[model samples]
Target chain A: MPTLLEIHNLSIEYKTRLGTARAVDNVSITLDENKTLGLAGESGCGKSTLGRSIIRLVPYPGRILEGEILLNLDEDVPYENGVVEKGQINLLQLDGDQMRALRGKKLAYIFQDPMTSLNPMERIGKHFVEIIKAHEPDTPKEDAQVRTKDLLEALDILPERVLDYPHQFSGGMRQRVMIGLGLTLTPQLLIADEPTTSLDVIVEAQILNLISDLKDKFNLTMMLITHNLGVLAETADSIAIMYTGRIMEVAPTEALFESPQHPYTQALLQSVPDVRKPDRKLSWIPGSPPSLTEPIPGCMFRPRCPHAMEICATEPPPLMKSTSGGIVACYLYEGS
Target chain B: MMGKSITISGVFIYLRLVQESFRDRSKLWWIVLGVILGGTIALVASLIILAARSNSGLGIPVVVGTILFGVSMLVVGLFRTLLIRKGTFSPRMGTLFLVGVTCILGVITIPVSIFILPAGWFDLWTVFVMGGVAIGIILLFLYSRYSWLKERGSPGFLTITGFLMVLSIIYMTVISYWIVPYDPAAINVGPILWPPHPGFPLGTTSLGQDLLSRTIAGGGIMLQVAFLSVLICFFVGVPLGLLSSFRGGALDRVLSLIMDAIFAFPGLILAIAIAAMLGPGVINMALAIAVVYIPSYFRVLRSQVLTIKELPYVEAAKALGARDRDTMLRYVLPNSLPSIIVVMSINFADAVLTAAGLTFVGLGLPIDVADWGWDLTFGWHQLITGAWWVITFPGIMIVLLALGFTLVGEGLNEILTPMLKE
Candidate 1:
């Protein structure tokens, strides 16, 4: 499988009042072509930050310190006018305009909060026109609106709803509208950041199902960020557990669920409450994840690791192949 | 508590409220209290009128009635505000400020009337009492300006102002032209200072120019100054604010600093100062007022843009390949417009008042231009000889026009409060 995105030693930091906190540490991640990569973590574990960085939409006061995000494209990217681009573009090096041109067409972000994700004053169809005309300025208003209505119809929303403002839609409908908007330009990659976190159980299931169907329909390679292991269980192909700005484990969904490596991954799986096993004892990992502020030279999950060794406090773990058939960033995975 | 809605061309509509907050109030208590307070003021004023019965300007009943009416309005506003503060009443902060502002202006008319009218129209004691009340209203307004703007709770005030504004707009745009019997600037059309009669409906000015025509046509320059000033403020303030906050860095800091510096001064006083420097003409008067108002629009828009540019939709726009220009124009600008509109309304009212203020201070348009400010400027002298109609009419127009824009501002505060909260 060809790697669609490769983040090489990416370091992102927040210049806060107290100190510089590394939200995304010297971490490297890769996504294969047409694959669903679920990035799961406890709250504030930088999953959303990583997703935003890919599209260069990381807000101010947070800086990408040192890194290279190499996007290996099969076709010419949506490069800025007067610029030409082919395969293997380093996203970090692209100018602001060039980076912007590549955003929606090459990759789109379906943000987390659907309630505020769309413009309140704008009608749903104008939201589509804004994005469509933004990328392709020559697109006519009628053509853009027609495409939006068609997209609305496909999302199971009434095409007429596009004429209505965002407040006129329910939460689930708004989420669907957001997804439809992201998919409007048929971007190859879509990053769903906690897409269902704000929704009810029924709506969450529907949205997850919608995302998976859309993924296959659009041939999208996705980075699904959420703390809900259950959501990732059904939707994602590869599951990655992130803790304190570091990826702890990455494996095929079943492999990680059945034979999870890394203590954080195991603890995460243990926390998922299942309805099938009526009397199954539910236990959670004790001790909160460590603060990311200031450099901590060791495995970030050491304090919470029940299987922590003295060496785990001093030695930062390196990601290595585990017998479970995926990568695991733990001392246990390395040879003795 | 019910409102009447009138829609114009299916495009423009605003709610005209009947005195909603006054109902279901410990209504009897306030009305009784108001009557007591007003009765007391009127009684004192009546005594002063009797003591100084030599003046032939305003009658005893008229003076007593004006005092009674003003005091009652003041008492009603204070009562409603107090009830709302206790959380026993649900109406927001609208009418309280309205009544306070009206009383303050009503108090200002005292000095104007005294200085303009025949000597001793108001006795010394009467001046002292009115002056004290004016001070109190001014203090209350200063104290509540922030919170009052946040919510101008319903009363018939908005509706009253709305209707006034609509009427004033019609007068300026349509009725003025329709009703004017003679050209305003045409001199010797009738005898000088001729009292309103069947032939010359509003009589004639000192130059024998028809007073009705002059009063009707007079507002053109004032309106022009106000509209043009607001336009300048919008064009300069909104774009600069948008640019500053959107591309934030040193430029944002600098622009914000300058706006704040301008804002630190009193609004009308600053306009007067600028108008003094520029020397009055049409564009110069507009420019003077625009400089005073730019900071208001700029600060409002800059803060709105700062918050709005970070909204999820704007971020989404950026992620969707929107350039800085597209995101600002399509996403940020439209979202910020509602706030700008509220500001613009407030600005129009302030501009109208400030333009009048400048003119009153002799820094407004040239005296020959049939301006209300100029009319008021010169017309006041005639009040001593009992031709009160001269100053009275233009003053009424000025008040009504200012109140018109002000009503829109207050109404919009209520209308947009819900949308703004979300």
Candidate 2:
């Protein structure tokens, strides 16, 4: 499969009264077409920031210092000078209008908080119509209405309820609506930013199933940002563990979970509650993730790494090729 | 180099803005209403001039017929469009249309009663009967059409009281011209210090002007000043508030300093100072009232915008690639309107009182114009002679109008705040 999106040497910093905080630091990952990558991290670890930066929508007080977000439009497309090839557009270099046109058409975002994501004043159908009209200005209202009804029905929502306000819907239903909205234009990439974080366990499972089903049906490339390891274990084809504004490990889901190489990834696996291992207590990683405001001299996870060595404090670990068909940024894999 | 492109883009942007605003069907009626209002004013002014100069006696009926026809057309058009949008009649829209029609008729009645009405054909009793019957018919029509209003219970006590008070003010303003047995400005029309009689219900003023007619006529001028001043405050203050809050830093700081400086002084004192400086006229009085009330609006709207700008929906709009202009106009502005509306209603009461105070101090409209404040000032000495009607009736009208606005403001606050929460 062709690479759908590639991020290289991405760094983002947020200016605060205290100082500049490096929210995302030198994070690089490649997502294949029709593939789902799970980004798992604790709170304040910059996972959400990374997801937003992919679309060049870093909020105020934050700036993307350096990065290249290359999107491949098609598998067989060739790059040409000055002309935007089928799949070779660098999103970071695009102007405001170009970026706007790209969003909700080439890519769409599903926000974290479903309750507040929608405008309170607008109806569900109005939201859909606006999105459609913004991109396809000449599309007839009836066409948009038909599409909205079709999408709502596919999500098991009543087509007539499209005229209802967001407040009229329950949390899980609103989340489904959000998903439906994200897929309205059938964008190539769907960025779900902790799509099920606010939902109940059963609803979370159902939403996860719906997302996977949609992915298969549409052949979509997805980046699912969540802190839940169990959710990632079920939904992701490839998993990338983020720690303190940096990627700690990137591997296929099976390889990463079965033979987790990085100490952080291993510790993350141990923390997951298992039904079979009733006697085994969940072991937690010691110490908190390093604050982004203060620069870490070496590895970001060094403070919490049990196998920390003297070199780990003095020298930054480079992402090295591991024997288990993945990459790990740790001193343990430096020589191997 | 940049200036040239900026100007070129600016023209296109403005054109696009006009195009988008015109696309909204509801705005078309406002434009039509504005044109009609201007035409009516021109027609009425010419008719008034003709009546004052000629003995033909044709100008009054022409004015009356034209105004009646125009107003009825406006009402019919508004109701048709409103019904088309909702597909069912709404009590709120009906009430608004009725109020507008009443105001238009009231203004027209002023000239009609002065020149057209026969000497003894119409009186206060006749006006009351006509008004009561009109109101009854409207209520019956509404009740039959919207059965839900009856089932939903009686709205609220404050809301109903507020609605009735406002309706009464409109009624008074409309029928003031034809409701009196004698002209309100006719001196020596009755005995001095006369108490309430069948001909002069509130008795006659010290000048022998009918107190009841004077009180009724006072509604039009008082309401006009209050509404105009509040409107000026709304237009001036709301945009400044939205801009400063949206574009903070230097602009916000400067605006805050200016508004705070104005806010520090007592509203009435500031209005008095401004009114005294501007000299006595209706426009000057309204301008004075508007100047004092602007800071209140500025503060209310700025705070609302500050909070609303942080909502997740605003961020979502940005993520959806909506421009800053679109986000501000569609999301921030609409979300902040309910609170601003509540503030405006509250300020309407303050404006009426302040305008009256200015008039009482001889800085309002000329004494020839029938104004409650002017009547109060002229009737002050009559109070000593125990001619209570001279001062009492005008004073009551002023208090009643203010109370009406206050009740409406309070009721709107109750209704709108919960809707915002939802």
Candidate 3:
């Protein structure tokens, strides 16, 4: 499969009253067409920030300082000046109008909280109509309405309930509506930013299943951001572990789980309780993730790493290829 | 030729559409009612015209009979609708009927008193006392059975009280010309500084103007200035506040600085200064009061806008490709309006008081104008002469008007703040 999105050396920082907090440090990621890349991290570990930067929607006080988010697969390259020979278009270089044009049609985003994500004042059908008409101006109202109805039906939501306000629906139903809205334009990339964090476990499974089914049906490349390894294990083809605004490891889901290389990944996996092995005590990593505002000099994970060395305290470990057909950022996997 | 045919066919088509819309069995009653109403109006209008043409003694009875018949039919229709459709008497409908009747009586009596009554048939105080009693009866009925009165609890009671006070002032303003025993501006109508008499009621002022007439007429001018001033303050302050908060940084800082400078002074004193500079007129007084109140509105609305702009729904709007203008108007403004309304209501009382103060200091409208402030200035001298009615009436009018607005503001605050929280 061809690479749908190639994010290279992306950095984002938030200037606050305290100081400038580096939310996303020189991070790099690649997502192939029809593939699901799960981004897993502890809370405030910059997974959400990285997802937002993909769509250039980092909220106030947060700035994307430097990055190259090359969208290689969009059919129409409206601006010809910066198109590479390989047909990759850098999203960061586009102006506001150009970015808006690309947002709903080419790259869609689903926020974490379903309660807050949907506009309370607007009906569900109106949300779909607005998004459709905003991108495709000449699309007839009847066509948009029909499409919205069909999409709602596909998502297992009652099409008749499309006229209902956001407050009328349950949390899980609202999330389904959000998902339906995301798929309205049928974008190439759908970034799900902790989409199921605010739902119950049962509803979370259903939403994840719905997302997986939708992705396959539409042939979409997805970036599923969450802190739950179990959720990633079920839905993601590949998993990327992020720590302190940096990717510590990236591998195929099975490979990363079976032969975890990075200490942070290993500690994270150990913490997940196994029902099959009841005797195995759940092990947790000591100390919290480093604060983004006052980052330590060396590897951000060194203080928390059980296998930290003197060199780990002085220098940040570079990402190196592992024998397990994946990359790990740790000294232990230096020559492997 | 083609244009004439098209126009004829267009009229036919429109008529057909209207017929089709009323074809349903459910809609037949509406058509019947419309026809009945149209016929009644035509009959009454023709009778009035005949009366005017003939100049006969039969005209008065015919006109009165037609009006009474129309009124009876309306009452019957209302009852029928209530009993048939709702199967119960709704308190809201009852309140509406009462208010309608009151308005009709006011309309009838005001014109009749102005045009038909002999100049000295009755003292102006008699009309005022009668109107007050009728209003009191209606208010008592509302207090007991008005649905919102029960639903809104204590705030609702306050709202009704405020509403009634304001209504009385409006009633006085409207009927002032017809009900005043003498024209408020007419000097030497009686002996100067006379005690309360059967005709004068309140007494004669220093200029021998009827104090009762002056006080009633003064309400009209007072309400006009206060309402206009509050309206100006609202228009100037709300938009500026919304714009400043939405487009923060330099614009916001400048607006805040300007507003603070204005706010730093005592409100009445500032109004007095502005009123003095603007010169004496009703418009000038209103403008002065508006300037003093604008800062309060600005401060209230700016804070509300700032908080609302940061809500998740606003960010969601931007994420959905909503333009800056759409986001501000659709999301931010609607959410912030309740606070603005509350502020405006609260500032109304203050604006009235400020305008009166400016006038009392001889900076408001000219002394000849029948205004509460001008009356107070004239009446103050009579106080030492034991002519208490001169100052007391105008003072009471000012206090009552201010109290009415204050209650309304407090009531709205109580009702709106909780709704915002929800």
Runs with alpha carbons beyond 4 Å of true place in candidate 2: A74-86, B1-155, B418-422
Model 1, residue B193: what's the lDDT? 90
Q: Write down the TM-score of model 2's second chain.
A: 0.68
DockQ (Cα-based) per candidate?
0.40, 0.21, 0.16
lDDT of 1 by residue, B1-422 (tens): 34333221111122222233444357675575345434433433332333224232343433343445446555656777787788876563555555556666566656654664446546533433443344334334434433433233442335333433434343233223323456667779789998877666556677787777677667777888888999999999999999999899999999999999999999888888888888879888899999988988888888889888888888877777777887888778878887788789888888888888888889987666777887787678878878877888788777767766776776676565433422
Interface RMSD, in order shown: 4.2, 9.6, 11.2
Worst 10 residues of 2 chain B by lDDT: B7-16
- lDDT per residue as tens, model 2, A102-210: 6777777889899888777778898888888777778999999999999999898999988778877888899898888788878889999999989999999999999
lDDT string for model 3 (B317-345, tens) is: 66656667777876777667767777877
Backbone clash pairs for candidate 1 read B94-B152, B94-B153
Q: For residues A78-114, what per-residue lDDT tens digits would candidate 3 score against the true structure?
A: 3223322235788898777777767777788888889
Candidate 3, which CAPRI tier? incorrect
Model 2 TM? 0.81
lDDT of 3 at B62: 29
When superposed on Cα atoms, how far off is each prediction in RMSD? Answer: 13.4, 11.7, 13.3
